[model samples]
Target: MRFIRTRTAKATAATLVTVPLALGGLAAQSHAQDASPSPSGTFGPGCSALAQKANTAKDKVVEAAAAYPQLSHLVSATVRAKLSGALDGKPNVTIFAPNDQAFQQASASQLASLLSNQGQLKKVLTYHIVAKQITPDALAKGSFTTVEGGKLTTSGSGTEFKVNGKAKIVCGNIKAANATIYVIDAVLRPPS
Candidate 1:
């Protein structure tokens, strides 16, 4: 009986020690997960230029884009498309904004024709936006529907990403009051 008691006590003692150690490992893992950094702030190569040119984190999407001189043409196009209110009013969104250089990439007549038609202009502009704010991590291998209801796919990892397998994200993960802006090197067109 004493031997049985001793064996039972040893088992109980081993369980006590083992249980706490197992729990401690789980606690450490939980803490590590809790401590892992969430995606935040801005990223990409053009961020340096953006830092030198503007700080629009506190402004609304339209106004934030306006703050960057590189985005002047995009801002103008957004206003002309009558999308300023829509973009500014969104609680959360992702804007794949094309810089002025991207606008210049289009033929003069093509740009003029699109601008002259409000419906087409709005469709083109909205094609650059996603309803949900997307992070750089998600931007890698992302397939999202745009506000224009056309699908856009993103590829590449780290700071380099492309839209529709073409437009390179120049400056990405930029924060605004209502949106996150990723400045792209080319305008994205919606599917007809």
Candidate 2:
């Protein structure tokens, strides 16, 4: 069974095509319409780091993520899930990528278990990715759907949006060639 949020038209063109194996992974906002929503409030520690490349960027989603040392584990997880094409090739994706330290805090056994199963890994990773672009303004209210077919509820305003009522959007509104990225401090787990 699949779970989806009560929302409208978050997915448009992409269906996560896979010729070999289906993989998953995790964007920021940069556009006249993709506003930051918060100018004075501070978010997570990585905000400054993300801001440095938040705008005036030309790299693709995955490529841009790979540039951030903090997102190394997320990039690796995406590669492991064989989701490079979905993220790198597709457009208008929004990713709530968890930093490396988030994974580092997971139980060694849990990490090992996910790494061992591609299907399970895909579901977990996709839970963090939305099929459509999500701006900080849009995130100010309502729920959203993940490619994994799960519900991600957002509350709070500006740079304080939280995912699943737990994971905080530390760095957000980052624009990439094919996606928007929100760096979160926690990795969102899909319902069993």
Candidate 3:
């Protein structure tokens, strides 16, 4: 009886230890799979600042962009260029919108010049847009034609990408009613 009890206790202890070890291994494996990048949904560091809301997805491109404070400069520029009507009418598009800091990066004179000339402002602004909605995967090694009729290339893996080999996409995969917006760190210029 004593021997049987000793063996039973030993077996129970071993089972307890083994079960947790096995479960822990399984938990670790599951966590690793979760850590892998997901192709769907928004990406990039700047995405953290974005307020995730269902209403944003329902709003039109111009209206959706207006909700984000960081995109105020872009919205203002688009309105000033009289592009709100045209952009709102588009069924699908990809906009590499520059943040306020990007505009500040340009010389005051350059910004003044661009903003003052409607034709030039329209050209420069249109260059930042593509006629189709682009996904993060497509952005990896892409050469797309801009709305301005200029060609721009994007390259990089995962969440990092650049436009025209210059402007880095600060935040990507943002959805609007008729557009996918990738907020870039610099303004893109069309080929003259």
**Which model is ahead, 1 or 3, in terms of TM-score?**
3
Pick by lDDT: which candidate is best? 1
Candidate 2 lDDT over 1-192, as tens digits, reads 133432222332133344122332211223422444653233544677663434424888888888778889899999999998888877788898998888998999999999889999999999998889776767767599889998888777745788888888887776677888888888889977
Comparing 2 and 3 on TM-score, the stronger one: 3
lDDT of 2 at 192: 75
Top candidate on TM-score is: 3
Once fitted onto the true fold, the runs of candidate 1 whose alpha carbons sit more than 4 angstroms away are 1-38, 51-54
Alpha-carbon RMSD, each predicted model? 11.6, 21.9, 5.3
lDDT of each: 0.88, 0.77, 0.87
- Better by TM-score, candidate 2 or 1: 1
| Candidate 2 wrongly placed segments (more than 4 Å) | 1-45, 49-56
Q: Write the per-residue lDDT of candidate 1 for residues 1-192, one digit (tens) a residue.
A: 999999999999999999999999999999864542237856666777764355778899999888888899899989998999989999889999999889999999999998999999999999999999898889778999999999999998767789999999988888899999999999888998
**TM-score, prediction 2:** 0.74
Off by over 4 Å in 3: 1-39, 51-54
TM-score, one value per model: 0.78, 0.74, 0.80
Q: How many Å off is the CA of 143 in candidate 1?
A: 0.6
